[model samples]
Target: MDGTFDREHHLIAAAHHLAKALESTTDLNHDTKWLLSDLSAHLSRAIELGKAHRAHNSSTAEIEARLMSAAQTITRLHSNHPKIWDAGHTTISEYLKAVAEVQRLTLSLEDMDLPKTSRELLDRAQNTLHSAMARLEDELAHALIRSKQGFLEHTEYEDSLVSNEDDSVRTGRFSSSESDVGYETDLVHPDSIPHIKSIAGLMFGSGYGREFCWVFTGFWRNVLAEHVAATLGFEQLSIEDVLRMEWELMNSRIRKWRAAVRGIIGTHLVAMKRLFDLVLGKYGDPITSSACLVEASRAPVMRLLNFGLAVSIGPHRPEWLFCLLDMYETLTGLQPEIDALFPDETGPSIRADFHDLLMRLGDSAMAIYRELENHISLCSSTTPLASGGVHPITKYVMNYVTFFVDYGETLERLFRAQDAGPGPNIPDHLRSLTSALEANLNWKSNLYNDRPLKHVFMMNNIHYMVRKVRESPVEQQFGDEWVKAHIGKFRHHATCYERETWGPVLDLLRDDRRVGKSGQKGMCRAFAAAFEGVYKRQTRWWVPDLQLREELKIKATKMVIHAYRDFLGRAGSSVCEKHVKYSEHELGTYILDLLEGSPKSI
Candidate 1:
């Protein structure tokens, strides 16, 4: 096993070895450091011996001394270095080239081709040179491997420092540290012991496997980044050497840290994002001072959500249906006291502020789910992995179903007495939200939709809190009033496509039996969405291309036309006319303009 790579398969083998090492061991920092240092020392000796042998090419006596030194270095390492197997290796194939150059020169100065004294000198030099060259080549190859080992160790140190920060979360039950000097002590369970490992291990496992994953990814990323730099003309390590080093590390280290760290960061990112969502809901817009109240306590649910996302969407992006699994788990742990709107359960409940934000986010996410699902279906129509749109829809909708249906509305009813009965600090926005919920106990993203059922069903998750919120008393649904107001605004925005403009389109969706559906309610309601997208940039007749052409220009216009034509062909003229019927075009449009451009104006 001369240390040189076989060129064809060595790098891959090395990576596997390194990866295995990383996976199998608990920690290499303490025990492995000495091996690295010793490896470095032996490599240095080999290089020095190679150099000395090359320098003594004119005399066998001198060549013998240099060869002996290399032999000792080899013995000190307890074995011949892999250089024997990798016999002709060097930096840039220098050993091969040197051998060829010397052989050619030696041939030119053969004994028969020169004078007696000169011939004798040439013979001795040629013999010594060949032997010295062989020994030097062997040592050079050995030294190269030792150098690589040195590099691998250096990378491990760097990786230990920058490997992703794992904010360890203690989720399982806590246990006492005492061994019971008294009658009783809380015995730590074997299963929980893993959870209570040192903070570092809990966050980013100290085991060999975890460290290996981080180090492997870091080293490979550096190598690739270096390759990118090389492509741009900067000089650095060869992709081959770096790649080889990566393989070696992978083989030795399996990176247990990856699973745990991934678990931790994913939890934090999810909670941070959800907190951001809740703030958007209650505050609408939080200024620096007031927003400080929305603190993340790193709750159990938050950790679970993060772990689910990491395992499902972010880190490994698995094929199994994880969103549903998470949804099921969240539902199984349901409690009675959670007020969906105010959502501050006294014990282990989703925080009030965060719950509020999650509801709004759930509402917003429905819109995104529709859009992204439609996009995926349109783009990947024929592919097998395309399950087409299912992937994108599952991403947000499945993960957040409980937030919208049970959590959001539950809080509203429970807190209604508290909100309306006594608080002078209540904002107008909060009050309006509750009022809207009272009016539409079944209010949702697509309750009015009649087509594709999925659109209505896509966000139709009114199971727990959402149903409760909608069904609650007017005062209980202060937040609903805010929602209704936005819907009103969206509804009015549809005027841009009214009978005068996009009228025929709305008619088809609402009343038309085309697409083979019976009701036009869904289509009639979609006007707000259609007009909002098309007229958002500019509503002027000269600005919106649809304003100029009788035919549509953008995606929104096309959808409207499709809904209208499909409706007109089967459902008839009255279908198109109803697009103008809901709350009057002027009223709806006014509501929309107010919601978007200036709520203060209202």
Candidate 2:
């Protein structure tokens, strides 16, 4: 009361007293609460007095003194709930309500003559409120931690109802007030605290909301930074395990971030980007840049590839490779959306993370291919062909090479800019390995006694390899040139088969002495012998593709028919009436049925 007569004197004493009180009181008390309530009411009265006295042309010092009293009073009130403030029990709405009240007091004096006091009081009130809000921000940050802790496991964390996709599934941490209303009628646990979302909503309302957005984004950046550091710091995990775990974690964060932003309106994009920069920008180190707390993500993606592509050539050849390819594609496909969320102009490009991820994936795939090619080159071809009629190595190679076919467009887009060309030297290595395989097939065919039969084996396998590569995305790597080259080789093999097996029969048909000499029937017996030997032998062999089989059959038939018909017309009935068992026409007809050899003949 003694200091109250001089307004300036009162405000100075109030500030000093309140500051001291706040420093001294570490515990909650009824006395402190009453003192705060009284001070708040007094400030309200002082604001009213100042506004009423303002239009009377009071001195600047006198008016300033009154407003300063109110300002100091509000600042004192901020320290009132020390225990609750320290414990983070102060709700954001409650804090904002107090700020709004103080703001209203400051605004009431807007038309007054006390320019200095009005500005000073308003600044002081706003600053005090900001300090209180800062404390509230700490609470909100803790609430996020609490929400995470409420879930016993990461799976439960995923199941939390705070998802941007589905807001109706109310988890206790984010449920609406309406959903929680029934808690009052039921046996009460602790009074339900405001949900994290409700608190966030209050903090984000209208005036000064932008500042809180910065704070909010900064908080999440720190949170995510810690998450990344923890994920990467798996000291006990194998490098492979560390990589896999980090991949899963990073993927989870990206997905959650994506889902979370779905509910965010376009207006909030700037704030969202700030958060993105904290998590993904190169310079967003948390401790140094808390206001813009961004940390660049260092994903253990290469190790993920190493584990995924560790497949050998024997049995599990491409399955592991396929699984990784799937992951690569999935991550690749999600890039645009995730990138849109966290774009940074001055920092590293938004697309850099995804681009790096894809490049690493390509490198991993190339590494796998190199290992597989080495394995293919060293492994013997003596292993029986797999059940699919392709040799084990051939099947493995085909599968490995074609695994990325579905991702052709993506790869082209990714590597399209490569001035040095697609390296890891994958395409050329694969082509050379394929040629080696062909040579190996030729060498292996020597194991068979019959020349024609050996060529058939070569034809079947080469045809299989060519067909697989032709139909798949492997063509992207191997190219049209490789395809045409292989197809030509297949044609050459078919021609060789005709020459080795059917050449003798056609030659005999054209022999003039064979007409009746030594009772050797002209070309009829020659046709029978050749058909019985070659066609019957082919009948036992398996051709996997029906389309290819038909083509081979047509080619083989055409070669024999023209020559046989010409010979038959030349030799005629003169040869037929002698030692020839069948007429010339009958001989012509028999060669037609060559591919369908009998089981006895076979």
Candidate 3:
């Protein structure tokens, strides 16, 4: 043989050479030399065998075919046990490694010199892998939907009867036939709603439903968050769009959840009424039954309602203002039933939970307004003064106040439910918010240099506030007395504008007894100059609100014109026709036209 030999001869020759090499390395320790020689021979043999296998291996077409077969097997197994594969039974790393292998094979096939038939087989196999992955994800989504649907649909249950030891046993244990009792003899127990049952199961297992309540609420919230992320994609959703979708989802879920709860426990009257009757008949008091119901119901049910309320305010929708109030009422609507059912012993503990639930809902509901205030504050700060309309903050605050006004009674109910005492109630919170906004308006008015223009800004805001309160649902919140107080402020600002803005014209019209010969002429000239200046400046400043503008002008003109008429009458007799510029009627008419002719007001 030249160099290569049969398997047995190769092993024999390699062992002999390693032994000789070990003997030659006498400077080294005996054991070390033997290990080094043996390792070197094995390394050389492995290298030679690797080259030989590469030379003699199957063609690229056969290799591609083998990989395709392996992929097909994986695909078929995955289709058969998609859950097992998806759940990573063989380990996530291994499953992903398989998927990566298939992807690599597909890409490699693109660059390979393969025949059409081979390439087609590989393409189909790769497509199968892709389809399997997609179907697995789709299956998971459908499975979750089905699970929730099952939870909802399974709310109602058939009543089961247990025979007392002394009770008569007939052909059937339970029957529709009437016994001594007026109604049907068979008594039915409530069916187990899945979510409620979940709570009950956890209670028995762990001593309370609090853990289950948290787990259930947290699970659904995570699912909802994932749904939102998936539906809206990686891009950001506008606040309005997010809030609209959140409201839609919350409203839809709340209705369904409420119905589910009602189906399980029945309405307050039907459920609690029947429960009370049963407890009184059996135990002589509802204290124990009520306690049981409270323990099971409070945590899970409140958690369910609160989860929706919390999520609804995620984007802080203003429309939810009334909805939240309504929800708060709905949540606490059970008070009367609780009192009637367990009035003596269990009432306080049960009612305490209801109180807490109301507090949570109120805090969540008010949180949206707080968010709006922050947004309005930011908008007011960044917005430019030149882009004048109503300031955005003003409009938003007005809307908030208007909303509170419309629902004042409902808010009062909420506060009273929380045990807030008589004086300075829920409206006080709203009053403080409005006061802060008014202060902000006052600061913004300082941006104007013209004193009267600044007063005009304050006048417009104060007028708007007073008018809105006087006419809106909020009218009830502020009361007639408070409203009149605001109206007084509105009038004060308007009168201040008149007194300050036209002070120069009024000063010119004041008679001076000192000047003699041409005194009337000099006074007429000075009066003409001052009056013309007032008209020009006032005309350039606009009052956009026609009614308020007309009102302001009517009052200002009444004051100035009355003073002007007296001065002109005294001067008209002393001065020549050439020196007298305006009659009393003409000056009065010009004063009236000043507001009408002014540039558009902010």
Best by TM-score: 2
Write candidate 2's Cα lDDT for 1-602 as tens digits.
32354575457457646745664665858787667657656665665565555444354445446545644654555567543333344433455455455455444555455456357655664565566556556665555444432101121122222222221322212223212211211101123233444444444432444454465555554543444334334222343542344333533433333222221211122333443333323332333222232222222222222322321111223223433344344455455544554445422433464456556655554445446655666666564332214465566556555544444454454454444365334577568778777777776777677776666667777887788787766777898888888788777776787788778767776766444544346356666666667555655555566676667666666766777667556665666566455444554454444433233342
Answer with 2 or 3, whichever has the higher TM-score: 2
Q: RMSD in angstroms, all models?
A: 30.7, 18.0, 26.1
Q: Give the Cα-based TM-score of candidate 1 against the true structure.
A: 0.18
- The lowest-lDDT stretch of 10 consecutive residues in candidate 1 is 149-158
lDDT of 3: 0.52
What would the per-residue lDDT of candidate 1 be over residues 1-602, giving only the tens digit for each residue?
22342332345445545554554565677657566556555555655555554344444334334444433433333243344424333322443333344444454455233435456545554664445444443343333233321111101101211111221211111123111111121122233222122211211211122332233223323432332333223233233432344422421221222222222222222322333333222322333111222222233234333322322222111111122222222322222212321133322344443344333323332334224323323332222211111122222222222122323333343234235333222234334333333223222322423222222122222221233234434224336554465445423333332333445435435634444333554555565555554344223222111221222233344554465445446644565466433333333343233112111222
For model 3, where is the 10-residue window of minimal lDDT?
165-174
| Model 3 C-alpha lDDT per residue in residues 1-602, reported as the tens digit of each score | 32454565467557666766766865988788877777777757765765554443344546566566657656656656645424543543344445455555655666666656566756664575556455434433333333442111222222121111211211111132112111221112333132233223323232223333333334434443443333223333333543556444554444443333333222322343353244222332335445544444544444444444444445555535545654454455545544554455654654565556567667666666446545444444633243222455555566566656545566666555556654235466566666777778877877877777667667667776676566566777767776777778767877777878788767766754456537768877888877777676666655555788888777876887787677666655647477767776766777766644444321
TM-score on alpha carbons, each prediction: 0.18, 0.42, 0.41
Tell me the deviation in Å of residue 487 in model 3. Answer: 2.5
Off by over 4 Å in 2: 1-319, 328-366, 383-392, 402-422, 425-427, 464-484, 507-518, 521-530, 542-548, 558-602
Pick the winner on lDDT between candidates 1 and 2: 2
Q: Order of all candidates by lDDT, from best down to worst?
A: 3, 2, 1
Off by over 4 Å in 3: 1-313, 317-364, 370-395, 405-424, 516-522, 540-551, 572-576, 596-602
- From the highest TM-score down, the ranking of the candidates is 2, 3, 1
